[model samples]
Target: FLRAIGKARLITPLRSEGGHRRYSRYQLRIAARARELVDQGTPIEAACRIVVLEDQLEEAQRINAEYRRAAEQADPPPAD
Candidate 1:
């Protein structure tokens, strides 16, 4: 499974001393999600790309929210 995904350049797990592939929690989640998408009739390549884009969009939204909070903190409202 990992080998196929690795070949597709989706989730690149690290290799241990014994040359065994080791995946992190993040990778596991991604793999599970890709599987879900594939099971939904999505193509393997498209599924991987969709998962990656979704993750990126979520991260970008999170960063934007943080920046908004920081900006609000840096500038206080007028006296009430």
Candidate 2:
């Protein structure tokens, strides 16, 4: 799939006798974000921009808070 999309260049290649591919954490993050954006109806170029330039820290925090609240609202563990 990566090769099909021409995103293989976004990843780093490992240097071996035959030159293998090795992706870094940053590359993986970019690919994941790209996939997410693509799933959300964003074009590849726009998705790359959002993933690379958009400040999503606040949104991430909000989502985390929502999840925490939901978890707290769930029933507690029963007595042993």
Best by lDDT: 1
Query: C-alpha displacement of 20 in model 1, angstroms?
Result: 0.4
Model 1, global lDDT: 0.89
Give TM per candidate. Answer: 0.92, 0.48
Tens digit of per-residue lDDT, candidate 1, span 1-80: 56767777889999999999999999999999988988899988998899899999999999999999999899977898
Instruction: Give each model's whole-structure lDDT.
Output: 0.89, 0.66
Residue 10 local lDDT, model 2: 41
Task: Report residue 64 deviation for candidate 1 (angstroms).
Answer: 0.1
Q: List the residue pairs that clash in candidate 2.
A: none
